[model samples]
Target chain A: GIQVEQSPPDLILQEGANSTLRCNFSDSVNNLQWFHQNPWGQLINLFYIPSGTKQNGRLSATTVATERYSLLYISSSQTTDSGVYFCAVGEGNSGGSNYKLTFGKGTLLTVNP
Target chain B: DTAVSQTPKYLVTQMGNDKSIKCEQNLGHDTMYWYKQDSKKFLKIMFSYNNKELIINETVPNRFSPKSPDKAHLNLHINSLELGDSAVYFCASSRLRGEAFFGQGTRLTVV
Candidate 1:
């Protein structure tokens, strides 16, 4: 099983601030995704970058598969962005179970207005 | 329309009771999964079904059973629920190797 670790277990910032959250895995992965668990407990897909970089509105993510690391960046954060950010990954060598995603503990972000 | 939806957004039951959570995906994905989020907010995979076939079953307890009637639906049943069973359960769907979409989550409280 692959292990995923998220950095800075907790983060707090004022609105309009920018922050970078990191995720490091112990093995190669074929699937990598970033998700935001809003205050209401809705898991919103942020990015599905197995490799390369992708940006969605004020959120962006980059995954370096070879290095087994990924970074999620939030620009000009708003109060609505406050919640838990999770990084989940699926091992490339899981055979028929490659679709199984192992999640990290997550980074708790709080953006104060 | 919701890509993935689950019934009973919240559930509360006494110990020794049996309850089931239903999940359906309109995205037509082949892979569906059940994940549990504990009180501390740690998320872990419990079971996964691909194309209506069970593929991944983590070290979950026997009390937790997951059934997939088709590629678009997966349901979870818990027998004799205990205090430890109280947590948020999430249903998700995705392509064989694509990004996953999660439901709003069912928060279960076992009294």
Candidate 2:
């Protein structure tokens, strides 16, 4: 089983601030995804970067598969961004019976105006 | 339209009772999964189904059974629910190697 650890268990910042969340995995992964669980308990997919880097709006993520770590960047954070961000990864080849995502405990972020 | 939809946004039942949560996905994905989020917000995968076949089953109890009648539908049934079974359950779907899309989640409370 692959172990995923998310750093900065809890974070609080003023609106418009920027923050970086990191996720480290114990083994190589075939799939890695970043998700934001809003207050409504909806797990919104932010990025699906098994490797490399990607950006969407004010949010971006970079994954170094070789190093087995992923970084999520939130720029100009807003009040609505206050929630739990999760990093989940799937180990081994993608299509096997043992393939399933293992989620980290997550990082709780709070942005206040 | 919702890419992944699950029925019964909230469920309240007494101990020893049985309940089921229904899920459907229109994303044409090959994999569907059931994840349980405890009160502490720790999410764990309970089961995974690929193309109507059971692929992965974690160390979850036998009281919880997941059924996939087809590629687009996966349902979870719990028998003799206990207090420990109370949690938010999320249904998700994705391609073999793609990102997963989750449902809003069904909150189950056992009294």
Docking model 2 quality class:
high
Q: Could you tell me which residue pairs clash in candidate 1?
A: none
Give i-RMS (Å) per prediction: 1.4, 1.0
What lDDT does each candidate get?
A: 0.93, 0.94
Q: DockQ: which candidate is best? A: 2
Off by over 4 Å in 2: none
What's the CA error at residue B36 for candidate 2, in Å? 0.3
Candidate 2 residue lDDT tens string, B21-110: 999999999999999999999999999998998978888999999999999999999999999999999999988757889999999999
For residues A13-68, could you state the per-residue lDDT of candidate 1 as single tens digits?
99999999999999988889999999999999999999999999999999999999
lDDT of 1 by residue, B1-111 (tens): 999999999999999999999999999899999999999999999988988888888889999999998899999999999999999999999887678899999999999
RMSD of each: 1.1, 0.9
- Give the total clashing residue pairs for model 2: 0
- Considering summed lDDT, which 10 consecutive residues are worst modelled in model 1 chain B? B50-59
**Model 1 TM-score on chain A:** 0.95
